[model samples]
Target chain A: MTKKVATREAYGRALAELGKKNSAVVVLDADLSKSTKTADFAKVFPDRFFNMGVAEQNLMGTAAGLAAAGKIAFASTFAVFAAGRAFDQIRNSVAYNRLNVKIAATHAGITVGEDGGSHQAIEDIALMRSLPNMTVFVPADEAETAGAVEAAAQMNGPVYIRLGRAGVPPIHGEGFRFETGKAVVVREGRDAAVIATGIMVTVALEAAVTLAKEGIEVRIISMHTIKPLDVKTIVSAARETGALVTAEEHSVIGGLGGAVSEAVCENHPVPLKRLGIQDEFGESGKPDELLVKFGLTAAAIAGAVREVVKRKG
Target chain B: MENSEKELAVLKAAANEIRQDIIRMLGTAGSGHPGGSLSAADIVTALYFKFLRIDPENPKNPDRDRFILSKGHAAPVLYSALAQRGYFKREELLTLRKLGSRLQGHPDMKKLPGVDMSTGSLGQGLSAANGMALAGRLDSKDYRVYVLLGDGETQEGQVWEAAMASAHYRLDNLTAFLDHNRLQIDGPIEEVMSPEPLADKWRAFGWDVQVIDGHDMNQILQAVERALTVKGKPQMIVAETVKGKGVSFMENQAGWHGSTPNQEQTEKALAELLANKL
Candidate 1:
């Protein structure tokens, strides 16, 4: 059995580990340190951690400022607050300036569970990906989260790392290598491809297995970085597979699906189907129940894969 | 250090030149903010000339003091100051708001050499300034960070959020100036949205507040000197200024907030500024 670990937990641990090695590392949070998991970094490096109350704009602005003074700054908060409340600050102060600020946001997508629509950042991927100088990362598992966080720290520009609340099955082993703008191929096949990001990667892997039992061999591609997209990999997948299905724990509009579609249409046109929240707000429900209600299960991904394969004819 | 008699004259002359740049740039660009840029000319002049420890040759020197124009609509003031300080050629001032020009409508730190931060959207500069101050603390750098905010720009909620963070972090290395010009794009700041009791608001947010005449070069220099002694809190200099300074017709006129001077008006404004006996 695969051990389950939430990407947010791995993010916090990675930050704590990073602080010891890099003296320039500083963390700022909008009073959600515990939830965002920057508390781990704060506990270890009290002098470098800043709690900017509940002000998300200031949290981003402060990170930009710190980056300006030659420090690698990480600003953390929930996805909704970080992307929605502080959108302008992130756009103008961080991305426009191309500062070395890492926006490590947690509680993305519907998996945020009980807090309801107000808390779920269903459109964060879209919001972050739209910025010009922003490098967007949606790590699928704990390993990817750690890799993305460390990679984000090493870079000298604005980055947005989307982390999740619920634990998912591990997709990578100890030897998993994280490369920016490079998609990792999990399970290769000949029939069609499944492009997934965030929590949807695990679900797509499960769906690929189920499709295999039905005599359909589907390729599973884990698209970790949403922006600076791996266009080469996506074009190759489309050309080789002849069809593709995109999955993400986010709105179908402007999420992984939209990004993939844009790439495929311009480079290699393939029949594609998107499986996601479908331009709608999520509500109060257990994460499991919400996944089922929103049709975000392995079965849904499998259905979309079959439909896209059929359209390839 | 007290400003000697000769030093004041140089600052005054520089400020007068910056005001002329503002009028010339706006007139050349055909459309740009002149009022706030003219209002904060003296303050920007003081920071660039007397207060800030900056270098024109190597503007990106890591240890150099940082200045962020929070009220980015007043880019002309900052551009003029940077040009006069020889960050770039003064002839580049005419390229304001022009396509393919380094001088963008708002400050673009990437394209411009001396810009510490890119600011155009309101209420974001103070937060970036606070971050720099925090970074200085983390890196043990003694370089101070300064930000200039417009009075009307305070209406942005992010400014207050930044205000709270500035105090919470105890950033003594940061100093913010409120260019309280009283006029915004729409009309009077009070009529549009009263940011009245502005001094109390800054003090309440934990800044050591000081009120001053923004155009007075001596007062501008003194306020910054006083800010250096502040130990734990950020300093907020509430500068009382006219919407437009120097030009007789434009001074205190709300209509001049964003309007550019016509060729005739530009010549007249320049002539009046040139006739100053300061």
Candidate 2:
């Protein structure tokens, strides 16, 4: 049996470790410390932790202030509130100034489950990627989430990390290294390539395995960093595999699909199919039920790969 | 901590010069906020020249007191102060709002020297100041954090949120000044959106509130002293001021809130300021 850990849980443990190593690290939460998993950091470094009490705007601005004062501030809240509610504060105070603030937003995408569309943030990647100096990351699982947090701490500008509420299967092992703007190829194939991020990466891997049984080999690339995208790897995959399928747990409009399409269309135009929630809101259901309903399952990705391979001449 | 009569006269003269600089820069840029800039001239003057322990040569000193122009539309006032304090050449003040100028339309801390934070959007400066204050406490540093806010800007809900946090953290080292010019871009604040019973509001938010004449250098200096002696809570100095102060035609007028002065109007404003020399 494979071990499963929520990305947010990894974020909490990673932040506490960061706090221990770097005294300049401080954490802020907008009344969602327990859910966002920042409570772990709060327990260890009580003096360095600030509970901003349901004020997302103040949380972002205060984090920017702390960053300006030479402390690396990691502010956490639900993706909906952090990206939707306090966008202006993040844009003006953090990104525009290029402050060293990291916004670690958890409960991203349709995987938020039971909370429904109002709570899930399908457009967070779009909103964050549109900013001038923001670095966007959507880690695959627990290990990558930990690596991303440490990487954000070492970086010198604003970063937006999208985290999930559901536990994902750990893809990388104990010695896995993470680098920003670099995509890791989990599997190699020839017929087609599936570029995915977040929870969808593991799903893409399963789809590749399923496709391999049918004599259709597919490459699985985990394009974690959304902004400052690994265009080299994406373009290379487009060249190696004649067809491409992009998957994410977010809206198909401007998430991983849009990013891959933008790169491939300009550099190496290939037959492509995007897999995710089509431009619509998600409903209240179990996480698995939502994934199936939104066509985000492994079978759905395999179906996208088949269609794209057929369109490849 | 009182200033002598001679010192007061000098500070007043410097403030008048800053007011002239505001007009000159606005006239050169051909567009900028004048009303709030003019109103905040005296307060900024008192801070840069008298109170703040800042050295232009060492702008990023860790121990230096920090100032945030939360009401950032009044960038001209801050620019004039920075220039006068030798952060840059005083002649560079005229390059404000121009292409590729460090003196952006709003304060850009990354672009300009001696600026504590880049703040164009309203209601954010106070929170940034709170962070600085908290950092000071964490490091056991004695540097104070000062932020100036627009009276109209308090209409933003985030200001109250920051107010609550500052009090919750017991940030006694942070002091905020609300430039109560009573006017915004549209019209009078009372008619637009009332933040009235303002003193009680700050006091209720757990801040040591003080009301003073914003244009009075003596009163402004005295409030700073009083704020330092207070403990266990943050400070909010509510300063009553005219929208467009000093210039005869512009004073108390909302029309000058964001409009720039024409060349003739600029000459008249400068002459009016020059006439009030010590």
Candidate 3:
């Protein structure tokens, strides 16, 4: 069994390490420091951590202000609140002004579990990606989350990193480098390509293994950066492989599926099937149950791959 | 330290000129919120020419005091003050709200120099100001942050959230001025959505509260002086001002909240402002 770690835990540890290296880095949370894992940084750097109460709007605005004053502010909150509630503040104060504020929103997608539909931010990717001057990242595992956090700190603009509540298996081995706006092809095959992000990357790998048993070779690509997407990797995947399957833990409308389709349709049209929540809201359930019910399991990706491959023929 | 009579006369003249410029800019744009702009003229004037330690040449100086117009519809006043302070050429003031103009309808910090924070949305500036204040403390900088909010803007819940954080964090370097003109766009602030007992609200929020006449330059300057002496808490100055002050027809009238005067009314308004010059 592979070791598992939640992306938010990786984010908290990465932030604390980053704070030790860069004194200019400051952390702010909307009274969810304990949950958002910003409390880790607060413990290390008591003077640099700011809990802005329960006001998401104030949290975002304050982060922008801190960024303007030569500080790299990492603001944490639930994805629903950070991307949905305080969107205007992020758009106007942070993105419009091009401030150096990183919004590390956690508990994204249906995996938030039991908290119900209101807590699940199925459209956070769409919201952050639509904003100009915002770099949207959805890391697949703990290693990628840590790398993305460091990369976001080095960059001088607004970044939104979506983190999950559920633990995910580490796919990368020793010395796996991460770069912004670049996609990593984990498994290479020619029969078909499965493009995935976040926890779905692990699912795609499992689906590839299951498909190999049936004499079907499938490729898997982990598209971590959603905005400034590695169009070259996606286009090549569509060109080399005749069929494609896109998967995510978000809505099929405007998340990874929408982004991939828009890129593929414009560059190279192929027999593509997007496997995600079918434009529906998530309900209260266990994380694994919700994943299975929402058709986000490895079996679902394999099924989509089979359908797309059949269409390719 | 009180301002000498000569300095007070100069500040009064500057405030009157800023009011005149606000009228000219709004009249040229043919539309804008003149009531709030004119009401905040003296406060803006005192900050720009008297209180704030800012250099127009080095607008982005690290240690310079920061000012945010939380009541951003009053861009004319901030623009006029910036122009008069040599942040930009005075001729550019006439191009306000025009096509491709840096002086936008609201304060855009990215577009214009000397704007510390981009604020058009009400109830958000106080938080940004608080952030700057926090950063100042963390860096051990003595730079103060000032924010101006409209009385009607206090109705937003985020304002109070920022208020709570400002005090909770013990930000002694931050000062907020509430442009208590008592009039909003719809009607009187009391009828629209009263944020009355305003002083008590700030006091309860753990700020050093001071209530002064908004249009009084001497009182405005003195309150700032006293606020600077305060330590370990944020300061709030509740300024009592008449909406559309200096123009007889517009004073205390909600109808002039966002309406621009026509060419004839412009001349009449400018004449009234110039006639009352100190």
Candidate 4:
């Protein structure tokens, strides 16, 4: 079995390390410290951790306040609550002021498992990406989560880091560095490209492997930063591959798929297909089963790639 | 006793100037909220002139006290306060709500100095104040955080949420004022949505609550003094005020909530404020 780690776990570990390095770092959680994995940081730096009960609005607002006072504040909660419940605070207090606040939201997308539609934040990407001065991130695995967390701490404005509850296999080897606003090309190919984010990046990789046997030679690009989309890399991939498929564990409306769609249409028009939730909510089920049910598995991405490739020429 | 006459005289002068600035800014902008601005003038003037430990020369001094006008539509009052305190030139007050002006429709801390936070949407200031208070405790810094809120703004659920958190964290360094003008954009707060039993509500929410005349400089100073001695809990001073307190025709009228004063109305308001000067 492949070794796996939840992105949220990496975030917790990275945050603890960061707290040790930067005294200005402070963490606030809205009663989900255990699940969001911020408890790890709290255990190490109890004085800097604030548990604001179950109030997400206060959580973000308080985080903005700390940032205003020159502290790097990380406010964590489920994506639904962070992007939904406290959107006004995030928009006005954090984003409008461009405060140094990191909204490290976990349990994003349909893979929140048994939480059902109400808890699953299928629209979080659209909600956050729509805001001005908000840097949205859907980090795929441990390395990306850690890098994104560190980057958000250093950046001078509001950032939204979307982490997954389900464990994902490591995507990069040792010494892998994460750069802001840059897409990582996991594999190179000529026939088509699969641009993916979050858990869907792993699925896209698997899909590329299967397509390789089928002689499709699909390329895979892990787009970690949803906002400030790497248009250069995306346009280059579109020109080289001539066909593209976007896969995400979120709604295709405003997630990675939507972002890639806009980029490709504006700059380099290519045969493109979006593979993710079909404008619907998620139901209670195992993470894997939900992925398969929502057509977010390797086979679905593979199918999307094949369809896009056929449209080429 | 109350504040000394000489000290009150200085605050009264500053407040009278802010009220006049509010009238002039509103008259120049052709659109702004003077009702709440005039209502909050004395409290803000006292903070800017007497109480707040802030330096006009170095606005970003790390150790200086912080103040947030949480009820941000009253930006004229804050801008006037900042200008009068030399955070910016007093001439900039006339450019409020104009093109490319730092005096935005609401307070923008990023653009203007001495503004502790940017707040426009209601009910968010207390939480940000809580965060600053929390940061102060974390860093073992002695800087205090003060915020002013509108009475109608407390109708927002987040104010109550922040109140609970402030008490839970025992933020003695944080102080809040509710500008209980009892009027909002729609109508009287009681007729629209009553955040009634305001004192009881705050006390029940674990705050050291005080009710005072918001327009009285002496009362405002006294309230500030008592709130400092509060231990291990935040304080809320419920300030009862008229919507447009100083101007004769504008006082207690809901119609002035967001309306601009005409040139004649501006002259009249200015004369009244100038004559009322101590």
Candidate 5:
């Protein structure tokens, strides 16, 4: 059974908790407080939060300054603005310096339904992961997201946490340790492994159930940290299961699929099929409608898994 | 006046040693940016030895004042200061730019202890510094944040965006030093891009701006102290300097921007820098 929780709400709760424990933890947002779910944290700890209008670059720069001053800063904004508008600042200021700045980018992927492709941040994982000293996290659901947030507060360097705006199925529970370079095997299987990240983890689990009914054993691995990738788990999974299928709510190119492929190729080569957006722009639609239109559903994962199995033969 | 005279002599000696380290490290690596490193040596020396309350033995000390080299290509100067301050062995300076060496051409915070921010690309350091400053205010920490900017880097629009934000936030704890050497990798800054009336521009942006000779120890220290005195506004010390300052052959030469001095040039440059010690 897939647990369901909202990632945005989890972020707010986790941040409020972090604020209480770590006095050095400060939060900054760029206008969209309620939507990004930082408003709750603001209301609880008003003194630590700063609403920096819509200037994402300024938000990033200020976060860097805060980090330099021995404060752990969590700069919140929509994924698109935080990753796209402030790429250079994030790269040069925060990443380059290796400051202890946390970039909480909400509204990631096609899950950002009605707002359309402009607000959706599908490329953020790749943009952030490519930088040096950047620890990238895309939690599977609310519980995992909360754990990742707390872990980021503890990590002594820069972290970029991708949070989805819409509600997601809960994947982890309390007491589940979210290690930076470890992947969680959500389900044990044998014939094929369905490696998934972010919101797609639940969809992959659903796909595994359907595949199991068809007598095809499916292994579901939740790959949360994109950079400092869980190469050991991925390589072991690839070696154990001759076929590999990667699913993500991001561009197929430089995302989870690419990361998995890089690990597999370098270690254990296997018949692989990547399940993600096939280099296409997301359009404005309902969240469910967009997931279907973009082939990011459980059906798509099942299809890709079947295809990889066939290719293995 | 006596105290000022004593501090000036120490600063001058420290600056000369930093410059000597920069040349020696670059000459050893055979591939490092000598120009900007040389130009920023005095400022880097003064910041580490004089201004910043850093414990070389305990670099990760929470209360320590932060200093970030925004123009990170000048890693030699930063590395020199860090090594001299005993953050690491001075012998490690020779490993600059070598494969597997911690002393990369650009500062890497992971490898080095004292480097507050890793920098190489232009116009991004200020934002990180802004983040640090904002964090300080939130935590009510007394530690100040300092950043050094290249004049050529000011041409990057992000610098202006950061400047506007620093003022708006009233980040009084932040101080930015601009190495206004008036030159860049491509010819002169005037020819490549105009950042003229730099001090006035910063003032208009709501910062406490000061222009001084970057190589002058007293002026640099005075500007830094003045920045600390002013409250409710960020400070910009636009220090005019000569690229490749201490080395006569490399001074003011655009070709030295990213070029490694050859074996012969390295020897000559080292000799010139050593001569200035007397």
Candidate 6:
């Protein structure tokens, strides 16, 4: 049953539950309600769910206004539109004011597949993290995405929850807790640390399992919250492991790699190799092909870890 | 209460106080947008004093109306309105933009008392306003949401996006004021980017529209009152105003959009503002 649930569907379910609990919780979408899976919210709370059409900027601004009116607004759109098209609105209207607006941007990173680079948001985390008060999150799977949606509802201020378009595996357990700014160590190893976020967390876990067969123990940590990052977990992981590899479905320039580097720079600097899209626009393809092309597959994670461990040796 | 008579007196007094505060605050800051601030002062004054149901004493009160300054560079106007409405002490206005001052260069809702949303970047405020209005409808609350936009700010694509959404949602509880001062930081709005046929644009978007003199307290108040009577449609009040409404030499001057008044100019502006005993 869980195998078929896309993170987008989980988001819809979570939003319905959130709307039930909090009367102040309102959903706004930029005409991607069905695609982003916010249609359930619209059906359940017709008055509360607003389809702002293809206007990402208005969706952000309207969310900001709702927040000011004392509502926790979750504005939904494609990650590219939420982060790229409406960057200023999210920055000024929402984050700058510290308005309680959750940006649940779907189709994040290369997972957007055939829609191509224009729709795939590869640098959302970097863009959001750069904003002072913006809290960035990238959930790994459907269960984790559900937890993230619930968590974002409870948390104040602006939160960017990046979800993918494709049907991701239900990797996290039912009772798994998703806390803000905390890293979830999915698998433990000793030879190298594979710190990953969003959909890449699954790849990191796979890489660890594959590497374990080769007698190379790789630890996988789902660093979901990219901003206000889980430094303690990362620092200890680096210190204990001696080598590290950062993986994300975002740009190598500034997403998870940049965040992990900042943490390592402050505490324990180690031999680190970053695996992500290397600062280039993605092209139309199947999800798997895109992931492989962008070097965001389990193979890439394993290669990065092996390379980093080799450098350490 | 004679709504117009009461509103006129209130607007007359509040507008003067706001103007005085803008001049003094900008003069003291030595860096601020006085021209735009002055242009927005009267509209903000009328809204705070007459139109909106807001209590400054309990600013975060659930039922109170919300106002967002999308053109946030004009913080002095908003600060003055919030202060004059008893959100904070008038003395705080003097410390405008100073270090440790609650008032920053732009409105920061987290720091200030009555600020509905933080806005500085153009084209974001209307979206925030849409959020509030939608929230109000969701919560079964009738509290209206208001936003102020600069004429030049209308050129931003986001503003149009917000307009369409507001109308589609039939957000009758939302009212937006466009300070159609026809001037921006660089020069006149027409020269910068003509936002002309503004009313037609809003009308085409399905919003109930009104064009009025923004500085005229009676007209401003009337437009706001008329917005309430319109059912199932949002209202856009396009207020034709000078870049700087009060004070000689500054009115209609594009340079004053962001330039702080010199000490001598401050003294002169203050004198002009106080001559009417604001």
**Candidate 2, B26-145: lDDT as tens digits:** 999999999999999989998888889998999999999999999999999999999999999999999998899999999999999999999989999999999999999999999999
Give each model a TM-score: 0.98, 0.99, 0.98, 0.99, 0.86, 0.94
Q: Residue B200, candidate 5: how far off, in angstroms?
A: 2.1
Q: Score the docking of each candidate (DockQ).
A: 0.91, 0.88, 0.83, 0.90, 0.52, 0.78
Worst 10 residues of 2 chain A by lDDT: A167-176
Native-to-model Cα distance after best TM-score fit, residue A107 in candidate 1, in Å: 0.6
Model 3 alpha-carbon drift over 4 Å, by segment? none
Query: Cα RMSDs of all predictions?
Result: 1.2, 0.8, 1.2, 1.0, 3.7, 2.3
* Tens-digit lDDT track of model 6 for B36-137: 888888889888887789887788887888888999999999988888778888889988878998998999988998987888888888877877787778
- Tens digits of per-residue lDDT, candidate 4, B1-278, equal 66799998888888888889899999999998989999999899878887899998998887889999999999999998888777878898989988999999999988988888999999999999999999888888999999999999989999999999999999999999999999999999999999899999999999999999998889999999999999999999999999998999999999999999999998988998888877
* Poorest stretch of ten by lDDT in candidate 5 chain A: A1-10
lDDT of 1 by residue, A192-299 (tens): 999999999999999988999999999999999998999999999999999999999999999899999999999999899989998899999999999999999999
Q: Who wins the DockQ comparison?
A: 1
For candidate 5, report its TM-score: 0.86
Summarize candidate 1's per-residue lDDT along B50-157 as a digit string, tens digits.
Answer: 989999999988888999999998999999999999999999999999899999999999999999999999989998898888877777889999999999999999
Model 4 lDDT tens row, A1-313: 6789999999999999999999999999999999999999999999999999999999999999999988999999999999999999999999999999999999998889997889999989999999999999889999999999989988889999999999999998898899999999988998999999998889889888899998999889999999889999999999999999999999889888899999999999999999888898889999888998999999988888888888886
The per-prediction tally of clashing pairs is 3, 0, 0, 0, 24, 10
Better of 1 and 6 by lDDT: 1
Q: Model 5: how far is A248 from its true place, Å?
A: 1.9
DockQ score for candidate 3? 0.83
- Model 2, range A199-235, lDDT digits (tens) per residue? 9999999999999999999999998899899999999
Q: What pairs collide in candidate 4?
A: none
Q: On DockQ, who's better, 2 or 3?
A: 2
What pairs collide in candidate 2?
A: none
Model 1 has an lDDT value of 0.93
- Rank by DockQ (best first): 1, 4, 2, 3, 6, 5
lDDT of 6 by residue, A1-313 (tens): 5465667778988888888888888888888899888898889888778788878878888788778777788999989999999898887777877888999998888878887778778888889999998888888887788788888888889999988877777677767888889889888898999898877887888888889999999888998888788999999998999899998888988899998998898899899988898989988999999888888888888888888899887
Q: Name the candidate, 4 or 5, with the larger DockQ value.
A: 4
